[model samples]
Target: MDQEQIPGGPEGTGRRRFLALATGTATAAGLGSVAGCASGGDGTSGATLKGKGAGKGSTPEPGPGGFDVKAENARPGNADWRVTKAGPARAIEGFADRVSVLPGESFGLHVSTTAPRFTVSAYRMGWYGGARARLVWRSEALPGVRQPEPAVESGTRMVRTRWPRTATVDTKGWPEGCYLLRLDAQGGEGQRFVPVTVRSAAAAGRTVMVNAVATWQAYNRWGGYGSYDGPSGGYASRSLSVTFDRPYDYDDGAGLFLVYEAPLIALAERLGIPLAYATTTDVARERRLLEGAAAVLSPGHDEYWSPEQRAHVTAARDAGSNIAILGANCCFRRIRLEPSELGPDRTVVCYKSSYEQDPGFKRGHPATVDFRSAPGADPESSLLGVIYDGYPVDAPYVVTNPGHWLFEGTGVKAGDGFAHLVGVEYDKVSTGFPTPRPIEILAHSPVVCEGRPSHQDTAYYTVPSGAGVFATGTMRWVEALDATGDGRSGANHGLDARAGALTTRVTENLLRAFAAGPAGKTHPAQDNVNAVYGGS
Candidate 1:
């Protein structure tokens, strides 16, 4: 359900749109229990059910799944303010507070609930003769908890549904207009509705999907083996053979470096673009997935890579797909996954030495681009012009290329404040065919380079390939998200709009550039032969 279109836009062709987002409803139980919420019901259980709702005020009912729907504050000693419902079937029973939406503004429905298990559903309430309304969003009381309703649903019911949250709806074809939004219960609760309006399409051109799901291990390794919450500390922390398949909670201190993803995702949506997600493995295996995608985003800490994944993305770009490495240390290493018979999935398996020493590693395909001609192969560094500095922090950065096109809209004066944005610095013994060149020096500083430790970061580069390739030289994009408790506000970071706009504009221009031009055309004129075999 796409809520992006407002009535009477350029696409005069009429179509139905979809959208979803919910707020203010009863809470449900936690993941470990089956009480309060309607369960799969395998029989023997102690959980009860009740149903209650507000507005015209339905009386509290007696039976399984029943409760009073009131707005009274919690008792003096309680810190949690909540709403609850008991019912025999799963249901949506409250309004996220009625919202009056302008013609194109984004509005969220806030809901709180306690049903042990609950789902928030929003449907267009009133009737419109020839107009179509979309419920473009649906989120859960809890983030990261997977509930499949077009509306928000919570895995554990005791928590309140949050704002700035999201759910996916297919709103690709709705005529702009006003519509009612409401919640519908799935298995335990009944149905309810709220109202929302569609604003003008003044912001569609700015729409660009922000991708936070890591194709690699640095920021997203939540569920597979070797997850941070799993037995081992994962990847760089250790050289263990662990595979991670789940997501990390940004609120959890462990994700401090990867949290920038939240706002980027949020901002993209606010700008009218859908923020899509995927594991690197998915990109490698799915081509149709990226079809129609103008820009391909690798946000926050995208540190790992697979042979197939790299090849497809490069193909997409060569075919004119724009690319954004929103953070540093991108495409740093490669790993192979081995399947498991039990438990989540195979760990992000890697044994690089076998590639150098074993014929099998050389005979079979390796994931990243390898331009190495002989024995020692470190294609990643060669491809990117720098290798991992192996250090976590460094001196602040300085700008040398403030005049570049990326800095166009921002009134940034050279040498004012640059390194403030960089998170890491890296360098290598520059050499060979894959060497970075015709690069624009965005920023440079006299610091110990990663390789020499005595002198580096003295130079930082942003290369332009028919399409521009911007590199921050530092791996600190996550810091922008952390600037404020909420990722969208830039003032929280002490960065003026210019600095904030720097990130936003670069992203905007890059996506637009990709959509406007063909990929591979940027590379030096070469034969049509595939540069990397077996990918396309």
Candidate 2:
């Protein structure tokens, strides 16, 4: 894709004129300072920031029960200590039995190491009185053993580590929230992490936040085989099926959680929104988890999904549970789950190839390929109001419908562009797909993708069931929350202070409104796609 065609690109004079109009309108409106911007050193306005400890210039203080802040220097982008770096390179590394579990349930850990022993610590992530995470528990140095990577099987290309359990942490008293289990080998060689969420089954009247674990496992290359084969080989070597029996090879075992999911989780907690947590697998196996929820949140980069999981979420929305997709490229791949040698429903199978290559394809099942492709033909746009477009381009997020409630504050106006917010991958409401009628395309930023001129869209749509659906239409939505570009989010994506503030305000508005209940019941989306673009 040519960079010159993107919004705010060097060759786009129209965008410059629109920017002038937007800036002028905002200045004339006399929008005051967004609340809470200065108070919380974290850069988010209206929310009290916590967890700024010693590493970031704040005083080192013990958390509840005198638990030491072991990861004092742990911040974004520091690869070594950041909760997201992948590991086991001359260091002890591990992963959890499950991405999430209910309180009072037992959670297991699988550790791999070159050292004889290692210590484990649990930090509950939240806005805890200026500390981002509070030390909850720690384990003594325990015996460890390194395990060999599992060999790839024939047709499926599935890899299973079959590593034995290293530790089991009882979750009897742990609060329902995001937690990072940190592992450090003896001799201080290095450290890594495994992210878990202690979920709540009783989600009545609360928003349900789902961590995209399936996508993480799909991309995990712990056994040298992810969905996408690395430089070592091509599609022939890629794993058609991946098991959760091994540690993640990226983001310190957190996979894509830090980049795509963590920021949104932190922000939701900071706002004290009534919330519960779960994994994509959890929802797939148990539909009842979202039965009475007020809303469901799908994080950034939720690409792979099973039919059962899709049905559950769609049914929940039909029952009036609002859904907010905070990123693009969501539900793009159709996968099927099967019981692993370790446990049930631990294997995700997606053969991104020809129908003949997929065993299930011949059975008249949804082809294990892109959701919008082939026999299934179930376009995500029908559910998300936008479909996955092209990739590898970065463009400004230009607001076209700033008057919508989602952009209530922060002084945004028509044609206001948040630089570099549209990136990596994006979505659009296209007539070629099954788009929901009466959808509102909020941001219409033009960019060139695969040498073709196209526009990315952030959209909102309402259904008769009183469910409100929203899509950010960009993969960088969550990363923009790191207003300071501190690398906590891994890559900065060129986001600046203005972009952060604008995104934060817009996110706050979305969450607050959705938390009230089904937003369609109160503020139904008015179809503006035709009005804005002059066509259906």
Candidate 3:
């Protein structure tokens, strides 16, 4: 939720009155004037942040207990240490960014404050059964010693500590959902909530499952900021891999990791729809996981794919199935994963070398086929009318596929706008990707050089097999909904209500289509979509 900025009043009377009122209220409530223990942590409540035994006028002695926004200059009475603005608070955001763990993976949460900083702890919240709530992940702050000063990076001051910010948390048994990680500091005015989602399960149902053949699970490794943010590491390069010690953790690499298909899940739960988690690998095994599923949900950032996964899904749809591709740069590369034990137990290494380096690892193998036109290429591009385009650009999206049933209740128009929906701009069905022209151009956003390059966002052709696929090449779709209450309003952020609803409907449509099939008929598209399309 966006915070409304309150206008500041006169310097003297206004400020004095506000402080006086706050002090009176605090006193009445038995709250301390000095920075004190925050509520709901293992530490004592109401303890000031002031250091214990130090000469007056000298630096205050370090306070006992944990502080979320630790800083050397921070003091019990300091007001500047607080974050009163919207968005991430500069002091503690570094520790609140993305945290990615594989299925059944365990990891730690680290928190360090600036010099003169206090203490902090973390918690988790999300949708359960249907309501929003949270649970404390830590009973108390992990132990650590404070240093007076630490090395500076990017010309900014930071405190150094060896606290056990690390822990062994696993993702193996949790159902896929949006999780909010709240970090709070002693003496700090408020808490910071970081949004993270457990990657969707690669299993379809009781039996069918998608495999995680070659999965690259690192964020900020290719470091590119949002389309509007400054250019950073590896933005211009196609791909590269960095080797780090097993269970490697970072505080600076927060920008790259974000929520996928965030809004769709919320909608599914709200509308009483069940979602199945699976990867391309599961699809290849002819697993019955998806057999009885009402809908298949692929959240944002589903870029890597395998040929068999593509073919089976298309075949299932031909028999009758529904699919929703919630984000962009999806189904672009056919990748191969060679398992290794050098990393954390569940961590797999997915190095991006040229597809030609090893013919066996090429895109045509069962693991890496491009399903574009059948026997070989991934059918995703042809099915969705898009291919993963290169990235680092954001542009407004225009609706062109207006006639499709997906827009049935949306009341959207031809020129209606969806902003920054396409990132890296690669898929344009009208131009190529073997997409049929008869496919409706429900939405189209024009692009031009802003010194850099751009691409168009388009939704094209349905499967000859009777399935419907929806793809948006934008990174912000799920995130946008959180910024705006309604997708079409464009108020809180740039999210569009119609866009949000359409995506959800499309996902439901696909799953329902797939479920309308025989118990073992994996590619039941024609039966699912209620239509028929046969190559012969």
lDDT tens readout by residue for model 2, 62-175 = 333121222222322112234433334736777776667776566667777887766666666655533556555555456667755567787877777666565555554445
Give the range where candidate 3 is weakest over 10 consecutive residues by summed lDDT: 18-27
Best candidate according to TM-score: 2
Candidate numbers sorted by lDDT from highest down: 2, 3, 1
lDDT of 2 at 381: 84
- Local error of candidate 1 at residue 233 (angstroms): 7.0
Question: TM-scores, in order shown?
Answer: 0.50, 0.82, 0.53
Candidate 2 displacement at residue 142 in angstroms = 0.6
The better candidate by lDDT, 1 or 2, is 2
Which prediction has more favorable TM-score, 2 or 3?
A: 2
lDDT of candidate 1 over 283-394, digit per residue (tens) = 6555554544455666665666665566766555444455666665566556554442212222454443333533235676453222231233556543343444444334
